[model samples]
Target: MRIKYSIPIVFFVALVIIEKENNIISRVSDKLALKQTPQTLVQPSRPASARPKANVSVTSQGKRSSDFMLMKRRLEDYSDYRPAAAAAAAVTSRRKDILLLATTRTGSSFVGEFFNQQGNNMFYLFEPLWHVEKMLTLDTGGTNATAAAKAYRDVLQKLFLCDFSLLESFIDPLPVDHVTASLFRRGSSSSLCGEAVCSPFVKGVFERYHCGNRRCGPLNLTLASETCREKEHRAIKSVRVRQLETLRPLAEDPRLDLKFIQLVRDPRAVLASRMVAFAAKYKNWKQWAADGDVHVDDDEVKKLRSNCNNIRMSAEMGLRQPAWLRGRYMLVRYEDVARFPMRKASQMYKFTGVPFTPQVKAWILKSTQASKEAGGIYSTQKNSTEQVEKWRFKLPFKIVQVVQKVCGPTLKLFGYKFVTSEEMLTDKSISLIEDIL
Candidate 1:
């Protein structure tokens, strides 16, 4: 039935049909009253009523029992973690060594703004210890925990806890085994400074080890009553032996302050990056395996391995930190930092005793933009998978398959997976490596 219609008539008919179809579809949909699929549930909008309250019921000075875990997680949500102004009200009167450890792909760059904002009041250092080992590792392997401990004890008096707080411990949190197991945490060394923090004896310990002004006078008791009265050059002789080993000397000072913020990220996205750079760019797994020279044409591999190793080592260090240190620490994840960087920056601003004002928040926004524009090979939106998982299409199937096989175990630990290819899922060679590139 061929029927000819004028252009205007055809256009009117199409419009009428669309409007009718839409009306019909709406009626049908309303009548059916179909519920959304269970798997497609929307995340509840975080309204005011839905937010948790973090007000400590007790007076600021009193001991009120509350689970830190609950508070920490809720705090990450940002509504409960408002400036409280306690952070800005806190005053700083001493020099300290602040440690901010990052487990790559986390927003440590955003955290960098906290120290950067302090201007000249603080002598800020980022990943100094990490840098020392990284440069030495692939070449000399010259450094170890003992050496790090010694430097921390003798040189730096005030320790700052700027990265991941306490981590999962194997046994007693203070034991070496605990530290070893948590190779991804940071700043867990309060066991060495409890008495110094709680009692006046800390000054005595500091005097015995940290007398920068030897010209002032001898620190030893020349008059009588101490164990080392016979020691010569009393000032130099008073230096504590333990200080030579690790951070023992700095622990005794009146203001041996420990401040830190921990940044975490979902390991899945972190591991997925390997697929794009290491496996994809090189074209296949067999080629990457054959060229293991990190110093050669594999800068991305070097960076990935370095960050992974750093995360592992820092986690080890974090489990051993004491409760006192843990109290001043924060546990922030990468997801939270990206979704609401202002919230995380405000937390850091508060923790550092600086006012996190509107101006500061604006600056933080600028800093975040700068971070995105000036990142390395693994650049993406800080949290969401849309930018990170682009390798699904950018990469060839064979290479992704091989990476899934070679580093799959480690990837699982971080929570990523290799799924059946959309186009080639039924192929038997999906997970197998091709002999040729």
Candidate 2:
């Protein structure tokens, strides 16, 4: 009986030890499983304050790593970035400079009025180069063409930038502290004569200031420069620049968004008008016309040839759309503008990206519709449609023949029909201007 009882006690003790070992193994397995499980799948049973901070530490480290990576990317991108082109684009998008290029007697002054009358936002300079040309001619006797061109370009670049200091250097009897009454054609630029540059002599009268009238004092170029800077757009009408290619530097300048509008007209009409407008200078031309004998070797004939050649070459260069001139060049015929003033003005304004204000429209209507021209030889007002053909009557057949002989290429290029006789020349029914398109 004692042995049996001892055996049962041993078996029960063994069973109890086995059950305790199984509980310990199960607890170990649960701890291992919790350690291996994803944080999202695990549910904590401990009090919030008693829990381990491992997950919180991991989240803070991960956030710091992510922010560091983002900062490093931004720094690398900035290191490779360039702002030159972006800055240039910003400058061009805001401001525009226009060079209205044409030869004398091409109705350039009239066309210049288009921009000059663009309300107060526009700063227009009419023939500022006239001063440069005159001073250089007087000083050098007009012998140094290359030097003159350089000086002209330099002054123009400065003037476009509203830097009158260089231009003031060219003015005769140099401006005293940038005050000059000697600036050539100062009255022509309405901006120069406006109240900003020149205070009114008689207040509240609304009389436009005239440089010749001497009512307004000497032009304060410092004030002029200030006014120029205030304007949103600047336009310069010049008859001095002979070649379009010479202006490439101005176009390429990052500071200036430059565009060129070349105004051309019938050479025959140009000669006829020049003869009447400049009697003393064109006396030889008038003599040749009267005598019906023109020496092709004469200086006058050579001048005509040179002018035509320059026009043709420049037009060809502009038409080819050279890389530098791309979208920056326009060829406008004076006849076209005269025939359709409003339409042409709108096209020009559109090209320069300026508003074609009601003031311009009203001015065009009044200027083009006048029964007769109101001003002197420099007058813009005219019955423009009639003016287109007026040269046909004023120019003699002999002179016309001479112009045709010397300026054939220019005439054909610009769509001016050659007149075979006086009848054809004078006949209003015969259209001399062919449609350019």
Candidate 3:
């Protein structure tokens, strides 16, 4: 075969290959693997001015690809780092809220405004859900529990929104979501309630509560979750605030923990104030039932009498109050509240997570003193001797005896002494208390 190879045959083969390359020149070049003399390798063209800036630099520490992807996903799902920043903003801005609790005519009006002044972070809610709970209980009582709940919640929403104009008719509606859709709904300020710190989102919840915006606010509280839960439930259900169980719902709210300050007054003084307030509001005793619409059952009448006697008795026993009330709820005597309103209010601040600032003390003195100076609201009128026991003197002896008889035991239980800065004699008050107990 080697001897037989011909130059003409080789020329024919080369000519065939050249013809194939001509058919597809681009692909044919890639296919060729030969290294020949004059083969060109062109350099990439660029502007000479291109250079890395001195200020800009890049550093690299290689992490495993899989680990990085996992971390990126985690960061997306739950990035809690931002909450701290948000809370810092809320605290600095002095935008936040606190729960208020007081029965009717217990100086709620002034008290509400008073708290608003001292608390840089505190927001005022003037009877949010005011009497709506009682009203719903009236309509839905033992009937349709769901309807009652809905009505109660509607009222609560209206209260939060401060839409009192439509409130009268709004509470009677059913299907809350429907009401939500039709009405200018203001969302709840639930989330910011118990959070250890405040945030813009939480602040928004408070801000939107007044005008109209339907949304659930974010809350980041350090309290038990139950407190917020129950508070929302009660707000929806329209439970009366006076009921002891009301505290259960409020305290248990995952959002709120109870730092209760149970403010109490001498029942005698309270009764006197009541009588005076009643007289001011009404014309005479007959109006108590007729115009004022005050009603008394056999049990309530008996209980009222019992309350007075027990109080009187307790006052005689000792000045040191019972441990039951003191520990369970900080006992703030009305007398103490009146005497050093600022100092006592500061005590409340320490308890209720409200900051006890000097400004708070100043605020209490200013607000409370103004009312006292007015000398109209439950005034203890001054006498020539600077001590007017006119109430003690003018109040019928029979009424005193009756009050002593009923509330005397409770008085000792409360740690009060029944006397007028006089002689210490037989403790009839104690004996009376013992009889009742």
Candidate 4:
């Protein structure tokens, strides 16, 4: 009698367990089927407006559970998917940044000013890395090109990000004197903070720039990220950056649309111009010093050769640029642009996708007019054919010969030939014989 009772109890318990298992499986299957089915999978019996929406929920131990809670959690935790939408938006709406990579005293400011004056569409930065040059003394002489390039690129990256912290730190407390003033003021364009009106957040930085007292401040300025993002173009002119390879990382970044306008000037003219400026700024070439000794070295000759090397390095780097940067990296001659402002300005504007409006044309004409000064360290003459050809008269024969000997190959590479006599060639010629050459 006892064994018979035990067998019946065991069978009853097993039957109840199986019933619960079947119920659970049925509920799970129904939930999955509903999820996998489209709206057309079933016809509504009632009018569409009156039909009840499908809902799936399960009750276990007095708690309701969602069929896709695990999936929802996984989706929420996966951060990588978020950037896809952001990146797509960035690709469509991001502004293009143009870099005017040039040597010192090459009239880069004049070019930069052209872009800046294009209304709200453009933001221009002038020599943001002159601070870097100051940091790297002449003794260092950019011996480690890679490190120098990296530092220059880093500064540029910061500038593009609209972070003026690095730039502000480099600002000297010195007043905007005749020599150091124009860099702080870029024609009629908006200030670094935008229109020169600074938001409370960036006010301190702008104040530190001493732009208010210096007359470098513009009437309008903003620290709004949207304002920067909304601009169609941003341009930076840097004389400190010598090699284009330094900017490779930035050019390759999908986050940025980086283009280089490698501006070249006549090396002879550059040498002569630099000499005049150096004499005026530094005062008294009578007491020049370099390399820890008071050796009598020609400042113009040293500067020309240095500028030539920089030009060559940049050209070599431009040639090696990845296939992605063909049209983006441009080589514009100052002579060409200065000679025909309307045409060259139009070409440059088109390249950067900025419309060459009537206002822009007028600015170009007025800025390059014979009576107006190009300002900054630029010559006082108009940006005319005369300005391009003026080097012939301004530079002495001996200085011209020295510059040609040093920079002739680069000049020829860029389609500039020496028309002067060969007899003037000297033993002091600075030849282009670097590894890249």
Candidate 5:
């Protein structure tokens, strides 16, 4: 009877000790699981075939403790493990889409070269929307502004994604099934003219192919698409995107990390430059300047007012920085860039989160310090400092007053001081540009 009772009590005590040990192990496992990294916790379970088979059996408390420690070590290792390929892919797959948005004759082309000269990693487009504006304005008689804006946004969105199919529809003498040499300002984009798109050149050469030289054949859109895809970044310089607010949908796109640099210039300077660059179109403006009679109510004057209003409104929207435009919209004055090209370029590059490459720096140095202005009206190369005040001498007093009166709000908003006289307009002694902008 003593032996039977003793055996039963010993059995009960052994079972209690085992239960306490199991509870402690379970608690430790729970704490270890809680400490695991989010990636480890969320990672899908390994297949039964892939999982390691347990070879050691727990037969003693000491052995179980050893197993618990092994489990802890494995869990810690799993938490820290990230495949090198995945890490590399995450870094390389990051894409930046930049839009250098501005009106024509606002030094957009010059600023665009900042991105354009970013070497092979960048796929830059120069006024691809010129085709869209040309085709759409003709089709809609320039009255369907809303429709045109939507179309511009759509084409830009697609182009950012490397889809040239939508843009092809707007190309005049429509692409013969996605092939065209007639892409407007094709030579302006170095990527389009470089290898893969235009080839049979010396391998490893960095010099861009000039379309004017006709060294390459017609642009193959398919090749261009592939080249665009291969690139890590895409930049488009456009004067056609009139309103900053119109691009909200693009800023919110899931696939793109898009940024806008809205380049603006003094309206007086812009008008003066337009008068010279677009002589045929601005004949009436030239006459008005000569005659000292700018009909304030004339269609041209009203159009100027409207353009200024649009620019001012867009700028106001960007400055207000609604949720959509936050961290995405940047306002840059053409005057600032002209006065300090390198500094301004650095800021712009930093804003876009791209490296201000040595190549771009060299280009800016060469382009801005040229002895004389090179190329046509669309040329980016010039003595930048001299270029800033060229319009002061060119625009007459009457025209200045006209712009000041019509675009008063715009002038004030952008910190452009209104000149009281021709002397003030031409005076380099008195700085027309305020630092406020």
Candidate 6:
């Protein structure tokens, strides 16, 4: 009986030892697998209570004395390292350039400002390609247009590469327009200025523009500073490039990580806004035309027509793009952004890998105020839904008819229904137009 009991005890002891050894091997394998994973994804989860509390009791010497407290502090020290490493990784890996591609009167300026006002991390250039457009004086088709398109791509490449020195060779002081000049002036404020205002960078723009006085110097200085090297994100808003294909090379370039946000607005709304702005800017349209050719295309009507067609073409290009190509190009509508500012802004920030900081949120709220207070067609200060449907009232029935005829299909493609003449004759139409005007 004693021998039988001894044999069973020995067998049980051996089984226990083997089980413990197996557990040890399993633990070792798990540790090895954990080590192989990228540090960014290796954050270990713990209970909330496990975190070190500052309010916990301390010893006479000010050190945490309790075992739980001591363990908590140690865990926190280890935990703290992860976020720092993660932030550094994010900083090194985030996108470098964002291009807001749109045609005229699509609220590109507003979108540009939205990107720019995010914080110091973001540097924005409003229509850097407008400089190129001014230089070429070319139309948007044929071999000349192709050459011009190449030049535009080249100039943008230089900007993305952060080499403003090249602007000295080709670009000059852009004529001080009220809209852009005001934006440049805002650069004087602490919230908007970038490194270009300081030494080394400022010299490049001054030399490029041959800026003799402060007349338009600040504007050029801001532009030069905003595009300088070493920023988390850099952006430029362009109305000059009518088609997305023109920017395909820049988007595909390996040397630069580029993102394109195709900002669009309802064609009818854009037309009405463009006409209103043109009328406001040039009080005497006939005299303005007689004085000089205002645009490559002559009359305001012609300009509006060309602009609507450009919007249509841009939409077609975006709609037909392949899935892989779509990753580089994101389409944003002015109506959606204006109607749902916070949500749309968040989407934009998320898409660009930009953090939605408190400062950016505050600026978005403050900037969306209507032009009524500031008194300009270019003012995007208003954050109201009113702007989204303003074209319904402001655009004349004939102009609406023309836009609906040309852009109806594209509008439907984007989910906007075409309005019929019978609908325009409704009492709601006349009253809505009168109330806003």
The predicted structure with the larger lDDT, 4 or 5, is: 5
lDDT of 1 by residue, 1-437 (tens): 23455777888999999999999999889765554232122122235254222232343212112122233344544333344234424444333334454554454544554554443233343333442233334344334545544543432331132211121111122223222221211111111112222222233232222222121111111111121112110100011111111332333344444444555443434445544445554343335434532223355544444344344223322322333333344445555555566766666665544445665566556655553446566332233323433444444455455444433332332233345575653343443221111
Q: Put down candidate 4 lDDT per residue, 1-437, tens digits, no spaces.
A: 99989999999999999999999999999998786453222232235355322222223211112212322232233242234334434565568788888776666766776776677777777666766656555673543556667777877887776655455445454323211222343332354545434423433234333443234332222242345556777888877776666577777777677777788777766665766677764332223322222222656445555567667556644543345554456666677777677877776665555556787777778778765345545543365655665556555555455556766546655555564653432222422211110
Q: Which stretches of candidate 5 lie over 4 Å from their true place?
A: 1-93, 139-143, 199-214
TM-score of 6: 0.62
Q: Model 1 residue 181 lDDT? A: 21
Instruction: State the number of backbone clashes in model 5.
Output: 0
Clashes of each: 24, 0, 38, 6, 0, 8
* Superposition error at 230 for model 4 (Å): 4.1
- Cα lDDT of model 3 by residue, 1-437, tens digit: 76467777888999999988788886666566344211211111222145222123332112112222332332233232234234434555332223344333334344444454553334333443533544455542423435544554444443333233334453333223222221121222222233332323434233323322333333222221233332321112111233222233333333333333444444544454455666663243224433434434444446565344332222211122122212223333444455555655665554443455666566565555453245555232211121112235333334444444445443434434454321222223331111110
Per-residue CA lDDT of model 2 for 309-417, tens digit only, reads: 7786677566544567666767788998999889888877766767789999998999998776377677888788877888888878988999998887677666678
**lDDT of model 4 at position 359:** 75
Query: When superposed on Cα atoms, how far off is each prediction in RMSD?
Result: 24.5, 26.7, 29.8, 22.2, 19.4, 19.1
Stretches > 4 Å off in candidate 4 = 1-93, 138-146, 172-189, 193-227, 280-303, 319-321, 372-383, 422-437
Model 3: per-residue Cα lDDT at residue 409: 42
Q: For residue 291, what is the lDDT in candidate 4?
A: 23
Model 1 TM-score (2 dp): 0.41
> Which scores higher on TM-score, 5 or 6?
5
How far residue 267's Cα lies from its native spot in candidate 1, in Å, is 3.3
Q: How close is candidate 3 to the true structure, as a TM-score?
A: 0.43
TM-score of each: 0.41, 0.76, 0.43, 0.62, 0.76, 0.62
Model 6, position 384: C-alpha lDDT score: 61
Residue runs of model 1 more than 4 Å from their true location after superposition = 1-97, 118-122, 134-254, 271-322, 357-359, 370-437
- Global lDDT of model 1: 0.37
